[model samples]
Target: MAVGLWLVGRRAATTNQPQLATWRLTLALPCLALPCLALPCLALPCLALPCLGSWLLALGSWFLMSDLDA
Candidate 1:
């Protein structure tokens, strides 16, 4: 579902320019990837304590990203 959204949004944003979309996606990758990584860390037992760290980092990163856009 996320991949589909990414593809649709990229296609719409770049029209027929695949390379442009790819480059733009590369820049956006970390923002998307970090939360995916953190979510699992936040749900597990072995890394339970680190879960708070992961959640906080994800929240901070998202806040900063949106703040920067404003």
Candidate 2:
């Protein structure tokens, strides 16, 4: 879903639709972040602290990037 949105946004940009591009790209951010937020829960018992930290970092970065878009 994230990849699809990103591609759609790129296509919109090349076609001169700035608003569509921005909206799709903005939507993609959370889609990208969803896996990061989910992975820790799925792998918690096996991966523990390291997995949590990395996913948290990813989630944080996603939030930061999303904020920049706003």
Candidate 3:
């Protein structure tokens, strides 16, 4: 969902539509927070691996791509 919104924002930016890009990027903020909010769920054995793996992946991607907009 965050990726989708980011893509939409990028497309909007490429098309010279700043307003649409801003809105799409703004909406993606909450989606990005999902992994952080779910961190506490890692305490459950059943969710440990999956949750940790996804959280790590999201964190890695965030760090790697964070400079794209700069």
What C-alpha lDDT values do all the predictions have? 0.60, 0.64, 0.63
Lowest lDDT block of 10, candidate 3: 37-46
Off by over 4 Å in 3: 36-70
lDDT (tens digit, per residue) of candidate 1 on 1-62: 35854885678577877776665555444445665554453344245346557778988999
Question: Clashing residue pairs, candidate 1?
Answer: none
Distance from true location, Cα of 38 in model 3, Å:
9.6
Q: With candidate 3 superimposed using the best TM-score fit, by how many Å does residue 43's alpha carbon deviate from the native?
A: 27
* Each prediction's RMSD to truth: 14.1, 14.5, 15.3
Q: Work out the TM-score per prediction.
A: 0.36, 0.40, 0.39
Task: Give lDDT tens digits, candidate 2, residues 21-57.
Answer: 8865554444355565444434333344456577689
Q: Highest lDDT, which number?
A: 2
In order of lDDT, best first, we have 2, 3, 1
Per-residue lDDT for 52 in model 3? 58
Worst 10-residue stretch by lDDT in candidate 1? 40-49
Candidate 2 residue spans exceeding 4 A from truth: 36-70
lDDT of 3 by residue, 1-70 (tens): 5566668888888999989888655544443555564334423424544665777899899988987866
Backbone clashes under 3 angstroms, per model: 0, 0, 0
